[model samples]
Target: MQRGLSRSSSLPATSELGDALRACRGAFLGVGLMSCMINLLYLTGSFFMLEVYDRVLPSRSVPTLIGLIILAGGLYIAQGVLDLLRGRILVRIGTSLDEAMSARVFQTVVRLPLQSGGRGEGVLPLRDLDNIRSFLSGAGPSALFDLPWLPLYLAICFAFHAMLGLTALVGAVLLVLLTVLTEFMTRSPARQASGLAAQRSELAIASRRNAEVVVAMGMAGRLTRRWAGANASYLAGNQRTSDVAGGLGAVAKVMRMMLQSAVLGVGAYLVIHQEATAGIIIAGSILSARALAPVDLAIANWKGFVAARQSWHRLNGLLRAMPAPTSPMQLQNPSQKLAVENLSVAPPGEPRVTVSEISFVLQAGQGLGIIGPSGSGKSSLLRALVGVWRPVRGHVRLDAAALDQWSSDDLGRHIGYLPQDVELFAGSIAQNICRFDPEAKSDGVIAAARQAGVHELIVTMRDGYDTEIGEHGGVLSAGQAQRIALARALYGDPFLIVLDEPNSNLDTEGDEALTRAVRVARARGAIVIVVAHRPIGIEGVDMLLVLKDGRMQAFGPKETVLAQVLQRPAAAPIKIVSDGGVSKP
Candidate 1:
């Protein structure tokens, strides 16, 4: 609810995600141990095959066969349990990481736009966190962990026969190369796909927000084609990644199968030459296949690995660039004055200052109105005052303390802001007025509603104060939404109430209510600033400022400033209307 923004100090340093990851080293080590046990146990099947052929069959002992079956079953069961435990542990690791970082990630999401103007990435940081968590929890990590055991499997195959060992070693090398190939092929396309997806998401959000405009103007077809173009670009990049991964995965699988067959053939030739026992044939094949399995799985998951890596890099950059805020010492609400000193302003995300070298001071119980031609920086100044846009230079102080000295929550409590565009969240009418405060009082909601002149209108609705205002208050008329927004600005009788074009959408009665609201706010010893589009909107203010082409042209008592600008006598009343015309005396 704090409407003000100031980058008055360096952002606090942050490396929390990295620290959280490093903290998980111990848990990852535990998973490594489980993997070790699981991989060693994988040899159970190969050795059992060896025993069946060379020991049990050769001796023709039924007891030995029964004993071998019992032993292999127990080992297999143990391996399965360890695997299950490892999977559970991995899942918990992902969840733990999410729990540690999601809040901070969301904080960055909210602050990033304010700091960077806007990169149009839109919630991508949250999506990046999700992508990383998914990669960790999925089969990718297991494949990576088991990849180191390939040499162990190869060594066992070597003990069976030299030819079998060579075949397995060659297969391992080939599979590793395929894995590398997959990495190289997919990285660039994955990056492209990610960007295109973000662009597509931005387009969808804009379309939804301006649905009325699009539908009203017969822009539906044009918008659809635009969306389709973006979708096609994203699809192209994503499809390229999938094709490369799938192709490489298929090749890896075929290579592993062929290697197993080749090892078996070598084993047969050795036995025919009396260089090896018949048992080594099947045993070597099984071991050789297991040796390369991890590499194959790695290749299959390379796409996710690349995507997660890119997402990881993006998050790190964003986090470091816009670190979490360090809350300042809490301060009491300003009840005395609002002071502006040498204030210079610009729109967020733009570099050039739109309003320059302006200074003003208003004691409590004073109301000031700013009048200007379009593009003269009236709105820009309003944005800076409410902390929506930080000033390039100078400071806005309340109670002689600079705005940035107040923490967002503390500042929000004392400040009320109504932008030219009235944005109301989906909720009951009372909730919107109260800014969704959890402990909002029923009486306070009504008080604000009445102050904005929307109270009588509210009682006529089906649910009165409880009436649902649907999405973005779509259920209300433009004037109704604007009035409700004013009620919101007046909620809790904020110490500094700022209204930008408050009467732009209001009828005559709504305008009277707004003028009264300004009067009441001043009566309560509050400082009120109104940016008026017409002279009538400034009627409640005793002082006025005129802006022209981003410069402060005049500032003084309301009638005096008006008369000076109009070249009329001080006693002559000059009224500036919305359409660049003044009323004659």
Candidate 2:
């Protein structure tokens, strides 16, 4: 079921990712300070080379040489500690990002299918979030942080010699151009790869879900061929992106190395001409390499950078499309009635309305049966009634308050639903029946099971209530899963129970048990709406609605609607069955 979409309003425009990062901004500031210190300390080797060559070797002073070595070693250690600390801070920032937004990301994943009307579309948001966090924590971010200090190293190179500075500056420009080229060349292919990957993943998931059909019908080879074609497209796109990034990264590395050698050769000429000391050669080479190191690292990690950037944009768009909903007030548990006014609902993520202009009112203790042909929207109506699909044009009111006026968490507690396809989480039978309530009482679980008339079947198992149900209740038969789902719907004795094709898989015994459950629900003032094709499935509903082509054809008390649709005589009597007797309505 779609959770929290019915919340009355959306929040104001804001970047959720930015907001999450801001919560961790203090640590970021601290990391920046450390980067500043670390970059300054990077100058140690250059200066030590300058000092040792220009002073110590010429003077032949052992004490001075030893002191310089000790000082330089200490500075190197400090830089290493600070660098390590900065990396740790980046990791923590990633952790902070996850801690702040993982829940929101998961919530969006759940709600995404409701908007897109597809199961696999939701898988990307969580993956996007992971991509962002991984980039932040990895060496990619450190390369970014180190980039700003490039000019500092360039200035120092100029102080050593003008030619050395010119060499380093030209290398920086070339590397920057190469980085830009990599980005432009790979962007389109990267985007195409991501789309193809999602498509391939969705197909694989769908094929696996219907694996039984594939194996039973001998169509495994056909699916495999289709899947292989999609995989080939994805691989081609991915390969193109990697080729651009990888080739440019190699160029950047070679250019940086060439720039370092050119600076050294320039320093050698300057010293030979007696315009610079011998130490200038080593110092200039080291400084020029340091200046271009960040650019080199960035080019090497360009693919990761692009992936992170795209993920950021996708996350931004998703958050904008489904802005965080404002928390609605807790409304009273709906008791007296359930009303749908001028309602028209399309399938989730669909544009054409499938159930149109539906208006109805069901009083407390009344049970409604929705009957129609396969294409007549009986199941769609039930979905809307339980707040799964948002109506394009109407209100689903509970008591006097609209459904949107209640928080989904609170509203969920008051409404129970069983969809046409039964799904059971992997857990013990007791957990499935109690809807996984942490504080569920065993008595309530037993009561719900007994009400569904599945208690006898459940207790026959070796572990009984404690028996584990595998994913999708893989160990249970079709009839057993349906019965357990019914028990779940009746778990809390919710004010309204919406069931779609409640007995589509049931045997005769199961059908009789379902009728008793509906009777028990109405006896306790809980409204029941069952969408069913079989007449036996409507056994206890007080009201009946017939539909054709998404529009209502007839609606009223069960017998009256039946008689009118069947063209019965006006004088004919209709028998309405209660627990053990019949009455005239």
The estimated TM-scores of all candidates read 0.92, 0.93
Model 1: clashing residue pairs? Answer: 2-412, 3-386, 4-386, 4-387, 5-387
lDDT of 2 by residue, 10-102 (tens): 223347877787787788888889989998999999999999999999999999999999999999999999999999989889888888889
Quote model 2's TM-score.
0.93
Whole-model lDDT per candidate: 0.86, 0.86
Top-TM-score structure, candidate number: 2
**For residue 470, what is the lDDT in candidate 1?**
96
lDDT of 2: 0.86
Residue-level lDDT for 545 in candidate 1: 81
**Residues 1-585 of candidate 1: C-alpha lDDT, one tens digit per residue:** 000000111222335666766677778889999999999999999999999999999899999999999999999999999999999888888888889999999988887777777764779999998988898898988998898899999898888877889989998988888887887788788889999999999999999999999999999899999999999999999999999999999999999999999999999999999999989999999999888888988888888877777777788778777767779999887899988899999766788889998877888999999988899999889888877678999999999999888878788889999999889999999999999999999999999998898889999999998999899998999999999999999999889999999999988998899899999999999889999888779889887888877877777677777777778565754433322334332
Candidate 1 stretches greater than 4 Å from native: 1-14, 568-585
